[model samples]
Target: MENDVLRNIALSYSPMIDRNRAVVATRLTVSALRTGGPLQADQLLAAIAEVWPEGGTRVSLNVMSETLLNDLLRAKPLSNVMIEIPSFIACDPVNTDAILQLQGNTLLLHGRPPSMLPRELLPRFKYSIVDLADDRRRNEVAGQAEAAGVTRSVGFVQSGVRTTAEMEASFGRGAVAILGWPIEDVVSQSGGRAGQPDMAVLVELIRRVDDAEDVDKLDAVLKRDPTLAFQLLRYINSPAFGLSVEISSFRHAIMLLGYKRLKRWLALLLATASKDVNMRPVMFASVRRGLFMEQLVANSGDEEMRGEVFICGVFSLLDRLFNKPFDELLKTIPVPERVYQALVESAGPYHPYLELTKAVETETAPVINEYAETLLMSLLEVNRAVLGTLTMAAQLE
Candidate 1:
């Protein structure tokens, strides 16, 4: 059922960042629910549980039918799930009765609780998700939960928080978490090469790939960094790789996957090599970006082009990771001309694809629609890529 309905849905996500800039949760947005069909609450949440089992996934949704709300309750013991209901739904006597039957940390109030709510029902909501993008909504809902005699188990979580200042402001106003990427906060706090001791090994390995060195040589380079070798082997062996035989060694993986594919994985590994806890979400986004980029060109029948785009997507965040401009870094680590051009020059054949990839992350329809039009891509293609890569990302993780 999850598979049957997933095709009609395009899933996008943002990490719920905490005061320490750690990704404490993930906020998943479904691009189409009502348009696709009646939202299948159970299948949707079941899929989420499988995708992010560590929990703390705030399922950003609004108003569900009585049957759908009942289905959500049956999705009990979803220990990591948090379903947001607009005030209209949460405050309704009928809905409130059903919501009280919900198990785990499953309810999040998307707006301020009306004074009409019975006082005891307030605590059922784990946290109030206030949208920072709306000044009136934030002003109305942000800090008034306490005053309303609402006892949110976890403080308010500010949604639409896109910048560092917003994060600071959200925390200052007593938000337990902010919904969205803390890219600026992560970049500002990143230690770059100073923190990532494996940078030298990764650089050398990448250089060997660029020079088209033999597998034996690449194997030797990987030997120098056991941690890097282990990371690669783990990914190859993961169910996502879809390999029959377990890849027990780096040499074996290289021989099996070939340089072109191996290079893509290496790029993913490099972008995610940072040890900073705050960078976890960035790493999460990089994997999806790389996979989405590859899927965009999946039918192009140009394997080389697909791999190049994948690297471009992954390396999109290298500047933030290494704390160096693309101009300086591209000189040392060789990338495809398309990738280099897109990242450093921001204008090339691949540039449009990169723009589309970033726009997909925004999860804003108009922005995505504009980019898709620029590249002559249909929304269906875009949705397929988004959903496919997210599923792949789930298996990869």
Candidate 2:
């Protein structure tokens, strides 16, 4: 009856016999058992088997305790499982042996004062250290673990000299180094003061691109920024919108491509934007709006004007980044009159498409539907065009 009840709950979340279901059922069963229930070992094992048929026989040793632990170890349902061993629990030799009996793939060593895992048990388990103080301890513990034939995957809680060195050393040793925050975050917080040379080189490259009148100088400048160079080459080589022959160098590209194309490429490069979680949604929204507007204009007998319309859409969100009015920011760029008018006052011939794009960005679906009907366009057709443009942009990126 208890098995039936547990199986019912498991089926409620998922009916498939897969890893996801096994994880979910394990969690659910553990939760139920923890809440003062005197469940039998066989019952728990049976529940696990029902959820994870393949994984039932190789259950990891360190995953359970007391009767449940014994049951899982006996079952041997899964080959490997990640087990977390608290310092206090690891101090007990009996508990350590119990955990080793299960033969887990990775042992997550938690708590402080790394001496808890007995010397005898160290040789048997492939372990990764977690929650170590600074980088010094991380390296020391990793070194000790490696000496014991355990892979030293270290976790650094706080940033310090030791932590940085440990990360580098671990990489040297081919061990996984998990950073708390992204490296970019560390750079930003450090005021970019540490990497002045790299930044100086980038700024110099940008300046060269800005000042270059001839293709040779521009090509030389582009070589400095590989990312920018690749993007430029991609833009020039794109078939739907690019030239027929592949240009050999950046200089060739600049000379063959007019000023307008150069300016667009530069604008995209300048936007070397970070993909922060908060800004990602907004950036995607802007890209979608731009592509939608371009498609609308393309279908309106102005296919050549799609690029200009796309720019207006992309620049629409510039206000969010600069914290200024959109029209005020337009003065800096050499955009077309139609783009300026649509963005600033919605006065240009492309204003309706721009407005429709904005409506889509804001999720004012009814407005887009009404506008599409009035313009004698199918909503599905517009959606497909917008999606196609978005896919193209993603591929280019």
Candidate 3:
């Protein structure tokens, strides 16, 4: 009956994209109460196979109790299917031996606990670790395994418990920590935990760069954080700016990219400091609005006007970030009069475009259409351009 319910749920929500390759899999736990007869395993496997087809479905049997192993071995008719054996299950001798001889394709160990398996039993199957919350233990296990020459792929599960220091340490030691949530969540939670630089420090770093009259001082500050150094190198090498040669170091990038470009890059990084998914869509929208407004004003041959438009669009979403009203945050940043007017009262020249962007974001379709018509642009053209800008902004991270 549980299998039937799962099958119904799977069928109700179809795959987002239909492809021949199988990406979705089902997990199951075996219990002594239900493992009374062979027919139980047979029925469960049949139900999953019916929904996802052979080789397309993966069934993991989480062994919570030691007595379930005997029932699993007795149910060998289902051996052709893949099953997951938890690493902790090795605590039981009989279950340990059964797992070693099970010939399964995948073994999922949770928490990276110390393993006591015999040397001979380790090489038979592929395995991955799950729920690895403690970074110190995770790194110790991964490093020891690598040093012992265990070549099978090792993956870390990010339960959001590991600090930024743990993540940097694990990454430095060459372990792939699987971040369970989005990158924003990782940034928010991990910041300041693993000695990862704090936002105030980042802001100070940017200020130092801005105040530096010489390239050497700026380069020294940039090198303080390897991650920031890497991002600067990547931005310098990106094809969008069309630079002639590869920038090898922070010093070289500072000399070549100039202070203005460096400040812009730092601003972009600060904007992405938070990894909250709730704020991602808002950030993306703000970036798009800023870039689009800049392009519009620049094409009109008004350089100063373009700068104001860009600042206006970017600061438009400031309230969402600081959790205050827009006017309240505007007073904190030193922006131009026109930009302030547009945000506060929608009275400036750029106010119409800002209003249009807000209208689209709020799903006021009629208002968006009216604004496009008023601007002498086709509704489809405006929408296509706005969506294209949005897509580009989202990839900034």
Q: Per-residue alpha-carbon lDDT of model 1 for 23-106, expressed as tens digits? A: 665566665532556656766666666555644333444323444555565556466667776776667676666777775656
Rank order by lDDT, top first? 1, 3, 2
Model 1 residue 386 lDDT? 73
Best-matching candidate per TM-score: 1
Model 1 regions lying over 4 Å from their true place? 1-11, 18-25, 31-81, 101-105, 114-116, 132-154, 164-174, 191-195
- The segments of candidate 2 whose C-alpha lies over 4 angstroms from its true place after superposition are 1-226, 235-248, 270-277, 374-376
Quick one: how many clashes does candidate 2 have?
12
Candidate 2: tens digits of C-alpha lDDT, residues 1-397: 5343232111101000121111111111121212234434566445444433554322222233344444543444434333445556666665766667656444545345445567766655454433334334434554575677864434322212122333344444443333221222222232323123333343444455445456675566556657667765775576535467887666776678755556555544333333333233334445555656666766565544866777777667655544446677665555678888877887877777776765543334457666666667665455545445544544454
* Candidate 3 lDDT for residue 202: 52
Sequence-dependent TM-score of model 3: 0.43
Evaluate model 2: give its TM-score: 0.43
Q: Across residues 1-397, which tens digit of lDDT does each residue of candidate 3 receive?
A: 4432221111101110001112122233332222223334444445444433444434444433344434554455243355545555544465656666666445555455465654555564454444434555554654686688775445443334223344444445444433221223333443323223633445566677657657776666666677777776775576533589999987776778776556555655554444443344344445556765664444453656865676677667655455545577555444568878887887877787787765554444556666756666554355334433433442343
Q: In model 3, which residue pairs have backbone atoms overlapping below 3 Å?
A: 165-194, 184-275
The per-residue C-alpha lDDT of model 1 at residue 1 equals 23
What's model 1's overall lDDT?
0.73
On the 0 to 100 scale, the lDDT of residue 178 in model 1 is 80
RMSD of each: 4.7, 15.8, 16.7
